[model samples]
Target chain A: MARKRGLFETFQERIGAVLPSALQEAQTRVDDRLAKIPTRLNEYGYDAFGLHPESSRRSLATSTLFYRHYFRTETFGIEKVPSGRVLLIANHAGQLPFDGMMLGVSMLLEAEPPRLVRGMGEYFIPQLPFLSWAAERGGNLVGTPENCVALLEADECVMVFPEGARGMNKTWDHRYELQRFGLGFMRLALQTETPIVPIGIVGSEEQQPGLMNLEGLAKRLGLPSLPVTATFPLLGPLGLLPLPVRYRIHFGEPLHFEGSGSEEDDVVQRKVNEVRAAIDGLLQEGREQRAGVFR
Target chain B: MEKVLITGIGSGPGRLLTERLRTRFEVLGVDRTPWEDHPAEVAVHVLDLRKKGFEDLLRTERPSHVVHMGFIRHFKGDPNRRHEINVRGTKQLLDHCHRYEVTNLVVMSSSYVYGAFPENPFYLDEDQPLSASRSYPEIRDLVEVDTMATGFLWRHPEIRTTVLRPVSVLGPNSRSMMAEYLRQERAPTVLGFDPMMQFLHEQDLTDAIAMTLEQDLAGVYNVVGAGQVPLHTAIEETGGVAWPIPEPLFRPGVRMLFGAGMAPWPPGAIDYLKYPVTLAGDALAQAIGFKALFGLEETFRSLRGRG
Candidate 1:
């Protein structure tokens, strides 16, 4: 009375038995965690500064696979981020912004109270198809002083790459080297009286190492910079996929300075230098502590 | 009792305002076309603002308050006629308002005068420049009408002239461009560009106008609904499917449809779908003591079961 089952049938039977329970377990965990969050937190569940709750939730779930499993991101000092209105000044690297995604995920998943960090995107990134809407829905606002001021006034945590596009398009030789930080973030923090939390991200520079930048072509195409990565252009869209580089994010102590947002240039620059130095030191520490790129 | 002369009573807001103000003031409604049904107490006059009858109506009615809702938007008529009816007509009306010594004047302008530029701030206050004419010439009449009103505001401070620039008035009875766009089976939207839009429900707008007349608030005020929604989301919420076309193809596509008499909007309206022209309602809320009764969801919900 023993009928031998086919290999495919056995596999299908095994998946049928396991998949629902696995999915149910995941759904329960999400529901329980979401239930614990206060209703006030859910106030921003729909749309806040172009953040679409449904789109953000879907994208976050997909990005979580990369953040938790692929990158194996280990976040440190996330608790240093204050409860209300903060400017997260982070080092920008990786021709693509996987580091920014990880930082955002860390804040949402690892922090005591999950916070959605609004990333200030490059000016041109919002011009791309599908990407722009998704970015806005995922809480990425176009980097403008007006937007920053409004977000801060709303008591939102905004992440800024003070290095701007220069850091993102840096060649492999200059990897891990901090570019000149713009004075905008400091001025915004001063204006809003929001604390600045310096963030240092490691292993992002190795994710997609840039060999050269086609500046002229990028300009013609209305892009900021078109970096020729090792795999990109040669491998097509598949080349755009980032290598699974383990990420270590360090959140430093909140830096507060006294002055109206309209401080003198030298004063702003001095404060900017202080933030850059803090980030540089953290980056150094992160690099030294890391055993390997994929660790 | 103060006699109030309201123009463009054929329009939705005008009709609603006329009905509401009739209870408080002796409402004299004037339009190029006669209203099919108007309240028995309200006196209705069929006269063009551009014609001498408008001035005669003003002189005869001798209303203490004058509300100019007669501006002919671009979509309804040819450009030259629209200019004659809107710009020249507005100039004539303003001349009469000054000549007749009307104590209060409320001119209905649109937020479109702010211009939908990529660099526009999220909430443009009343002081923002009228930049719509910079790109699209069709709306030049609206900008000019607003300019003339503002100029009249300061020149005739004794009149207490209030220019109300309301954002995209939408409701069941409204025929505004935004409303018309939403009424379409498939609203055309610029692909990859979903600008945030604010809508002032027809009732709320009438309420604001009533408040303006009652309070005699004299300044350029931006009246907007409670919240904003992106164009795509707005279409979706209104149960209309969006036909997303690439940016480069949008103008040409609109031009083709318009040429074929199939599209409701002209090609010049492409910029609006690409960038936001959202207005701040702070002045209306704080100064005029009026808040929008309808939220964004309610505004969109009102569009349900309507074409």
Candidate 2:
């Protein structure tokens, strides 16, 4: 088994041979961070959620390229994230989930005590071929309340995009504008007694400028939305590639709310609103601090 | 010695359970099928559970404890016959247990009754609905039997009833659907969706049953194995190659093959392949200190050569 190489690992090794010094440094850094993170693995070296350190290494190595060079992501207040169970509530954007990747990488590379952030993906995620398995191997699970509660109970860090698809499908005109937040996260926070860390990410919103959203076509094709960007529908799949944009991630201090999680709907929504406001505040700060989108 | 009447003695775990329980209790076996082999100490009764003869045996023998495992599990045979035998048979068995004044009843249910859904929690508790019939309609009989057993638990408080919903059992002596899937050199799986799967060794299942019989706890409990593994990883560990078929082509293709008698499971079973149905064994663990001795590797390894 040690002699074998997975397709991803082999591709990474080929990349490593070309880059040599830089890629090797990135690989060691990723390995070092992963070694410090504790997880309950079965005899076969797979966590209950199908996360294997070997698979995560390959995934992190690929993401490190985007984090370090492609995006040149700068993280702030990563130390604000408290140890033990935490719910990192962030404003989601970027037609794709580059924002999620950056936040996850921030938690891994920038945090004092590096923590593996388990991302909650949309329901449609599991239906997509290859992505579903790869997502699980990378420690991102289908965003169900039960999955979140389970992770929190186990004292693991969980990331949730309360804005969901509404924020991801926002047009370029609506960038940095927080969408209606889902109250489920607040209820979960109350239920699990886990703290919520508001995260604000800048530059992901400008990755793909959405001119118009083709709701009908998206519904027909069974997609979240069909955005008519400057390049998309014109450049096809290649157009989906996000333009190089500097990413600034801001992690805020932990906010604690006390409740049995069975509170009234209005109460939960109010608490959710508080979280949304905090994220909005952080997004403003991130935007003001960044010199420019590319700088 | 306390007498224990075990139904479905002809099945894979049936014989094993009898062998395990014989030392502590005087074991009596009953099954519609014949228990052909010679066992001088244990007596075998070949009778349909729904028939009058089973009631006669129960009344005469008067076993203090009853372990029911006689459900028809396969998708083969007439659907009506399967339902009648599984559902009606269980109702009649419960009635006989009540009539014969049996002190204890252990209904061997399965975690598959909860159904495999993308929306299912990682570890489903006993309270979760038996929604398997909605997706896998062929197993409605199993679901009905399980539901009936739960109802019987509360209605008949005098008879201490325990329902054991064990995860997919696999081993050399196992005849479960999961075991059959792993036995194939090339197993068909839903493309793109690799759900987490749990497996219990047949010996561990028997051990759970033995433990349940020894304890006085009465309620519905999920009997899980050591831990869980991805479906594809489980296939590889068990020495089987996964043949991933796209969902669009997989469902209908499986149905066609099943109709032609070339497939192990019907199309309904595809949902299970596509989604996870993991269960929490904490209830049983805390109740009787139940734990599976076989790890995921050893459990999968058991199915290697037998295939």
Candidate 3:
């Protein structure tokens, strides 16, 4: 320029010229999208089922960065999830449960009429300290039959992973393999007369690849499992960071069954097998369509 | 005119109940100390319920209705004194009420008697066991007083006893532990738990007591406000910050503060903050035809230096 500005000053001037408009444009887009959501439908109220509006809004904003920018998550067949009182049954894997967060994001951002999907967490979630409170505030509940029935009765969309912890702790050699499903969710679907939507989440299995598990150490530390990954423990806390893998979420058509929610093992198992087959079918289809693991 | 004897007049709800009932009935108040700002229409008597002189006052007043609002809550005094006043004093009062042939007796119990446990159902009805004493010895007196009152109710059908187990009472003038905790600049919370809580306004509870006295309801009822909120959310709405600490460290921290006389609550009180003990008020509504004028939000708002 006229005064022969320094290199730092030149860079500062360039950033100052564009940063405000860029930030304002991003803010406006988020506000417009949020304004479209029916925020008043806190049918359970602000903290109902432990879903705090402030906490949830903040958590979702942070997760959105990972969902859109880091993972570049793409959702397909989102319209298949019916409105009101439906159960979302999905495959669970990855040492970390980012899959649940991704599915929640897809429902909020991509669904026709954005719905808050309440996820049922594992049994050990409530035992943890800060994680338990944060999880609840983010609209996750302890997995229990009573909680599921109450949520459905309140006309909420609930997401569940019937595979439980077994699926989430799979080794690197067994990636993408679906675990045996628990039958409780089937009984819940029948009891509430709610339709079920089978979801197949690809890429989450490869997010945090587990090589081995240290059971004794994990038990002593009060953890479900101590996973030894390529980057974990070896790299300390930094190793816990998930590798950026493109996520593809497939939501299948809703399936409805008519029966009394019974505790009989055989009766419930038959229904569980049907839902399991649907998810496995979707998982296979998603794999065939993928260009590559990281694509 | 019918006469009513209201005990624990020094407490907020007791005084409020006296003010509301004085216009309709001749009211007499009995407490360990005198109420400095009570209405002139009500006659106040200074005496201890655990001591020997209350029986004579009962004989002299011969009140048609007796309101037992004098139970010593844990935060106000020493544990031993609270136990003696709550358990033994209640027993003595019941014996005197039976002997005097009082037509109606209303006792104030707390929802805390149900105890805050992990496995509790969403809404605790009147039939739920008094489990608070199991974990916290501080609330043992409350369970005993409740047991004695219910047992006395069956023994003397003519008394027509109604035990009102209300949830946390909060207002501009409330002195309950919950109200005091909410009024703090920063409310301490358990690191891992955010239990749903219900609050009833002081006026609503007084109104319920008035109804119980005016009517002939004769069973235990759970009195609660319209709705509930998570403990942290309530604190946030009231413009207070939540100071969360780990569960293991919380007890020892409270103990240190208590030792220095800086903490307002006992260490045993941490259990309530960790789990929920919310009560369903449907039974109270059905029994007394009661509906809360202030919802849960309004109740919390009232605690922020406004009525």
Candidate 4:
């Protein structure tokens, strides 16, 4: 059993030695940010939603590469994200969820005091293989109202994308145009008495540049949408990789609505529309400010 | 001392519960299978719950408290026979409880009755519908039994009926599917899915039962453990390597293994491996001040070898 170290073992041993100084610094920053965030972990060091600091570190370390170099994400008014029990409502795009990740990275690295933002993901997220537990470990829970209420009650920051699949799967022609917002987030905010921070993301829509949506194919494949992106069908799986577009994220002022959560559909929709219009304004402002998608 | 008639006293939990309750109440046991070694203080009756002899035993004993836990929990038995004993037997027992004026009736239900669906929220309350049978038809009998006991609770207000839907109970001698799954050196898991799981230490469940009788809580309540953990973490904590299989192969594979009597749980139990069925124990805690003494690590460790 006393064998000499093989070439593979030698390479593995030098992982830390080989890592660039930028990566080592990023890893330290991720660990430090994660340590400062207060989580109600059980004795086994996992939250109810399976968010562990160890898992978060690995996920964040990988995301840090894309956040810093790939996307070069810039944030504005991140300090407007109130400390306790608030919602970060943003427009979701990029056939994948890089927008959500960038928003989360902004909260962790850019926001004052570095808050941990829990993204309320779709229900089908748990059905996928590796993405299932990875999302949970990254602090993204299934977007059930009860889960949202529980997290808000615990005084944690929750990020919500009211447009859902419609926004994420929209074609390039409909880019920067907000879809119909779901009123569930408004109802939850009202019920929990939590403030909503409207946010707008600029460059994610240009990442994949979806041409058209194949709804029937998506249904048969059990996916939300099968977007025929410019690069996807042409380049196959390689095309699924999003373009390195510069991301401009703007966090608007917190919006608070009054009344019990049992309001009529129109009443809730009106509140939802107000938040949607705020996001539209932000999106327009972001588009006008950015020189180009790659800038 | 007050008399408490316990059904399914032959099972591991039944025996543990009898030992825990015998000190305070006069414990009499009933089960279709014989319990070979039982304390002399507790009378263990080996008779089918549907048989007339069982009703006669209840009538003659006239026990004021009845704890019904006699249903077969595993899928190894005949379906028709299992249903007959679980459903028909529960009906007969409830009739006897009403006729004999059993002041307190505690039906040992499980959180599984809620069903492990992706739509299930983090902390399901008591009022949530019993939708387990929707996906898992094999567990329909348990759901029916819970429904019957709940109806009995409303119909007979005199008898305080407490239907406890506790999370998976685990311990050294636990015959629970979870305990059996953890015992495996390579436990198969659904690839990509690791639902958060809750575990109640066997002793904590026994205490909850005892406390239920002492307090006479009348309603359906979800008895949660101290906390929850991911399925993979629980497997690791119990010294088992999680063998993740894709859903397509894992479901039918488990089904075949179960049909051949090689696997511990049925194929329908795979949803549990995929989605969470976490419960809110706040009701029980607020009602009886119930707090679990054992943590998740200790609970998972109990499933390891008794050594």
lDDT, candidate 1, B275-296, per-residue tens: 7787878877999789999877
B1-307: candidate 2 lDDT, tens digit per residue = 9999989987889999999998999989898889888367888999998889999999899999999998888877777999999999999999999998999999988988999877776788898989998988889889989999999999999999999999999999898989988888988787667788889999999999998889877999999999998888889989988887788999888889988877767898998887878888899999999999998888988999782
List candidate 1 stretches off by more than 4 Å: A1-45, B74-76
**Which pairs clash in the backbone of model 1?**
none
**Selected candidate, larger DockQ, 2 vs 3:** 2
Number of the candidate with higher TM-score, 1 or 2: 2
Interface RMSD of 1: 11.1
Q: Global lDDT for candidate 1?
A: 0.82
- Across B39-137, the per-residue lDDT of candidate 4 in tens digits comes to 988899999888999889988999999999888888877888888889999999999999988999999999999998887888899999999999899
Q: What is the TM-score of each candidate against the true structure?
A: 0.90, 0.96, 0.82, 0.95
lDDT of each: 0.82, 0.88, 0.81, 0.88
iRMSD, all candidates: 11.1, 3.4, 10.9, 5.9
In the range A71-104, model 1's lDDT, one tens digit per residue, is 9999989999999899999999998888888898
Listed for each candidate, the true contacts retained, as a fraction, are 0.24, 0.58, 0.33, 0.73
Between the candidate structures 1 and 3, which one is better when assessed by lDDT?
1
Give me candidate 3's TM-score against the actual structure: 0.82
What lDDT tens digits, residue by residue, belong to model 3 across residues B1-307?
8889988987888888887998889999898878988788788899988677799888888998999988777455677888988899999999888898899999899898998766554567899899888877778998999989999888888778999899999888788878888888878888767787888999999899999888878988999987777787678777678887777899999889887778777787887887767687888888779998987767877888743
The TM-score obtained by chain A of candidate 2 when compared with the true chain A: 0.95
